[model samples]
Target chain A: MDYLEKEILVLGCGNILFGDDGFGSEVIQYLQKNYNVPSNVYVDDAGLSVRTILFNIVLSEKKPRKIIIVDAVDLGKPAGSTFHLDVDEMPEIKCDDFSMHQVPTSNLLKELKNFCKVDVKIIASQVQYIPEEVSLGLSNVMRDSIPSACEMILKEMSPL
Target chain B: MGKRIIIQPVSRIEGHAKVTIQLDDLGNVADTRVNVVELRGFEKFCIGRPVEELPRIVTSICGVCPWSHHLASAKANDAVFGVTIPPAGKKLRDLCNSIAYTEEHILHFFFLSGPDFVMGPDADYSVRNVIGIAQANPEIGKKVVRNRHLGTQMLDIISGKSIHPVTAVPGGFSKPLTQKERDKVLPMAEEVLEFAKFSIAFAKENIFPKYLDTVKVLGVFNSGFMGTVSEDGALNVYDGKLRLMKPDGSFTDFAYDSYTDFIAERVEEWSYLKFPYAKSWGEGFSMDVDNPKGIYRTNSLARINVADKMATPLAQKEFEEFRAKFGRPAQLTLLYHWARLIELLYNAEHAVELLNDPEITSRETRVPVTPRAARGVGCVEAPRGTLIHDYETDDKGLITNLNLIVGTTHNNAPINMSVNQAAKLLIKDGKYDQGILNRVEMAIRAYDPCLSCATHNLDGRLPVRIDIVDSEGILINTIQN
Candidate 1:
C-alpha cells in the first residue's frame, strides 16, 4: 500500500545480460543520472522480475493511477526506433508463453489495465541485436537511444 | 508410416520446450522426446570475470530462482577464497533460503500448478489459470496472494532486494540482522507457518483425494533419487553432503566437491540440455520407464524420499504420513506436489527457528577472504532441487573455469521418461485431446522444472509452433498456440 502513494510509476524491464535487450534498464540508468523527477513519481529497474512487481501492483489494496513500462522489443523495425503503445494495442499473449523472464508480462499488464482500472502505457524500442549467447551490454543503436527514451519518459511524466 | 504429434512450448512452466510423441503405423506410441533450446555460451561469458561478481551475474540466469544461483555462487566463491563464514553468517544465509522456499512453494501450489488440481485439469484452457482460480475460489485465492506478498516483504527486510540479492558475499553475509530486524521477521515467519499448515491440510482434504488415481498411475516411473542431508540423515537444504539413494532405498553420501566422480552428464543429439545420470551406480544410462538404469530424480519428491526424516517437528509428522502412504522411494510423479508442501512446512518452521537463534543477530557475520588458485564446488538444495555451482579461480581470484549443474538439468532424463510414460498410457491408438495433452504436461509440471534456468532467455516472448510430420519428415499439419 505504501507503493500506491505514488501517482506515476515508471518501470524499466529487461535483462541486462543479453545484448540490446537491456534498453529498458539502460534507459532507467540514464534517467536516474540525468533527470530529477518529482517525489510523486516512482522509478524502478525491474529487470526480469517485472511480472512480480506488476502482480503486486494489480493485487495491492491501493493502486497507482498510471503505469509506464519501458522495454526492448523485436518489432522488425530499424533498431532503436521508439513507439508508444496503449494497453489495448499490445498483442494477446497465450498462457503457454508465460515464463518469469518472457512476454507473459504483457498479459499481466493487459489484465491490470482492463480489470484493475489502471492506465497502462508501454514505451518499446526496437533492438539492434539480442545475442543468442550470454553477451552483456547494449548495442550502439540502443545505447544512443537512451537519451531520447529518457526525454520521452520525462515528457509523459509532466501531466502527472 | 509413423506420425509425430508435437506440443510446442509447454505452458505454466518456467521455460519454453517442445514435447513430441511419435506413433508407429499401428497407431501405438513409438517414442516421446522433450526438446529444449539452450541459451548458449554462458560459461564462456563468465571466463576472465572476477570470481566475486559471479554471485551477482548468475542472478540474471533466471528470474524465477535467482536466490538459488546467488547463494550457490557465493558458497562456491567461499571455497575458492578458502574462508569459513561465522556461524551467524551461515544461519542468516539459511534463513534467507528458507524464506525464498516458502515464497516459491506458495506460488507454485496456488498460482502455477495449483490450477491443474484446484480448477481441475480437464477444465477449458481459458478457465485453467491464476485468474480463473481467483474467480472460482476468491477467498482462497486472496489468501494465497496476500501470503505471497508477506513472503516478499519478509525477504525485502532481510535482504535489501527480494528479486536479486546482494547480501550473501564470499566469506559471509554482507548485511547483519539487528535484534529489531529479527523481531520484525518473527511475526511474518509465524504467519507463513500458519498458511503452510493450512495449505497442506487443504490439499489433503480437498484436492489429493479427487486425484488419487492419477497420483497412483500418472507418469509413474522407477528411478534413483538425489538430495542434501545432514550427518544425522535429517533433511538439510542449506548445507549438507549429497545423498544418492537407489530405488531400493540404499544410499551413498559423498562430499559435494567429488560430485563429478559420482554423477555424469550425457548429451543427446535431439536436445541442447544434458541428461544427468548416477554413474557411480555403475549402470549405463537408460530411460526405460519400467526399468531405468543410472537414472535419478531431484527436486521436492527426491529430497523427501532421500532424507531419512525432516529436521522440523511438523514437517517430520507430515513426512511420516507421506512415506506410510507411498512407501520408500515413491515413483508417483504427482507426489512431487505433496512433497513440495511438506518442504514448505519445513522451511517455514526452519525460518522461525533460525530467527529465534541468538547467533542470528551477531555482528561477526563475515571473514576476510584471501585469493587463491583452487577449484571449489558449492551445492544447496534449491526450492526445485539440488543446485551446484563449481568454479575454478586463478591466483588473482578471476574465474578461469565454471560449470553449473542446475536442478532442472539433473532431472532432464527423468522428465523425458515421465513424458514418454504418460504419453504412452494416455495416447493409445492415437486417441487424444487437449485434456490428454494437458495431462501429459502435468507430468512435466510436477517436477516444477525451470528450463529458463537450465538455458536462459530474455525478450519476454517465446513463440510456440507445433508441427505434425509423417515418417518421411514431411510436415502434414502445423499448429500455432
Candidate 2:
C-alpha cells in the first residue's frame, strides 16, 4: 500500500535465472545500493510477476504520477544497447494473447497510461545471451550495461 | 497427398506449446501430437547448494505458482531434517495455500479460459480476450477484477509478498500471524468466500447450461485420476495421502514417500517432457484415443473425481451436485472449469475456517531443526494439479539430488490425447478454420497445463509457429497467430 503513495515508481522486470534477462533486476539493485533515491520514489524488482503488481497498482486508491519499467528485450540490436520508449511507441499486442506471466511489460504499461491516466516510460536493453539451460548471472556485456541503465533511470527521476 | 496442420503456441494458456495434426492421403485426420520445450539443467543447478535454501530458490521455478513451490519445498525440507512443524506453522502454510488457490482459480476461470465460455468459443479472436470480456460484460468484469485484486491483497497481507513468498521455512513459517493481522484478514476472507459462491452460481446459471452438450463429448476420454485426501477420505490439498483412482471410481491410497511403488514416469522419444501413468495398474502406456492403456489425469476435475468427499461443507455439496450430473470420474474435459470453481469455494471456505482457528495466531510458529542426511518427498495439490518435490541431501546438509514432478507434467500425455481426440472430431476432410483450430486448443486449455512451469523457462516467451507440411515432410503452409 505504501507503494501507491509514491510520486514516482520504478519497476525492474525480468527473470534472474536467464543470463541477460536479469539486467532489469540488476539495475534496480544498483540504483538502490549506489544512489540517493528520493523519499517519494519507490523501486521494485517486479520479476515475472509484473502483471500482478501492475494490476494491484491500477486498482489502488492512490496512484503514482509517473511509472518507469526497466526490462531486457530482443530488439534485434547490438548486445548491451539501451533505448527508451514511451508507452505509445511499444508494439501492438493482441488482447487475447496477453498472459499474466508471459505478457510483454509494455502492454500493461500502455493500459495503465490510457486507463489510469498515468505517465509511463520504458528503459530497455537489448539482451546479449539468454541461456537455454538453467543458468544464473548475466553475460559480461549485459553486466557492463547495468551501470549506464542505472544512470539513465536516475536521470529520468531527476526531472520529477 | 497427405497434409499436416500445426497450431503453435496455443494462446490463453500458461507457457508455450504447439499442436500438430497429421492427415492421411484421403484428407482424414491420421495422427496428432502436442510438443513442449522442457527446461533442462534445473536439477543440476540445485546440486552442491545448501538444502535449506531450496524453499527460497524454488520460488524462481514459476512466477504463477510460487507459493505452491515455496510451501512444498519447505515441507520437503522439514521431512529431510526429520522435524515436525508446530500446529501454528502447519495452519499458516495451509492458510496461504487456500488463499493462493482462490486467486489462481479465479484468474484461470475468469481471464485465462473464461473468454471461450463467456464470449462463445467461435467468437472472433479479437473480441475473445479479457479486454473483450470487460467491454461485453462490464458488470461481471468489474466484479471479477475487484475480487481477484482482493485475493492478491489477502496474499500480500499474509505472506509479505504475493508472487514469491519467504515465510515458509524448514520447520515452520518464519513469521506468525499476530491478532491484528488475523483481524485484518478475516473480513477479506469473508469477502472472497462470498465471491466464490457467486462465481459458481453465476457460471452454472449462465455458462455451463449453454455448453452442456459440448461439456459431455468434447475431448472425452477414459483415464484414471490422482489427488490428495485426508484420513477420513475427505479432500485435503496441503497434507494428505495420495489417492490413485481407477477409471471405474475405485481407488487405492499410499503414503507420499511410497509414491514410487504406485507411480512411474515414462519418457517418449518425440517430446522432452515425460509421461506419468499408473504403473501399478500393470498396463503399459498408450495414448490411443480409442483405448488408452495407462493414461490418467491430475488437476481440478481429477481431484474432484478421485476424492470421496470435500473437507469443507460448501464444496462438498457442490461435489455431490457435480457427480449427480456427470457421474463419477467425469471424462468431460471442459468440466475442469466447473471443478476449478468448486475447489475455489473449498479454498475460500477453508481459509476462513483456518483464520477462525485459535491456533492460527499461536506464538509457536516454528520448531528448531537439526539437519542430517535424508531423502524426503513433499506433495501438494497445486492449482493446476498435484505437485511433488523429491530431494536428497548429504550429511553436510547440501542437496545431492533433486526431482520435481509439477502438476502440468502429470497431464502431459492426457493433454496430447485430448488434443488429438478434439482435432479428429472437429477437422474433417482437411476442412478447418481459425475457430476450429481454437476448438482444438480448447481441449488443451481445459487441462490448464502450465508448460512454462513444466519447462522452467526464466524468460517466459513461448513463440508458437504452426507449420503445415505434406506427406513427404515437405513444407506446404504456415500459420502464425
Best by DockQ: 1
The segments of candidate 2 whose C-alpha lies over 4 angstroms from its true place after superposition are A2-7, A33-42, A55-65, A76-81, A86-118, A158-160, B456-466, B479-481
The native-contact fractions of the candidates, in order shown, are 0.29, 0.24
lDDT of 1 at A145: 86
CAPRI-wise, candidate 2 is acceptable
lDDT of 1 at B168: 96
User: What lDDT tens digits, residue by residue, belong to model 1 across residues A103-128?
Assistant: 22336777778888888878888889
Candidate 1 regions with alpha-carbon error over 4 angstroms: A1-6, A59-61, A88-106, B456-466, B477-481
lDDT of 2 by residue, A19-130 (tens): 7877888899888898898888888877766766675565455678889889887767899988897666543322212244222232456667887898887898888888
TM-score of 2: 0.93
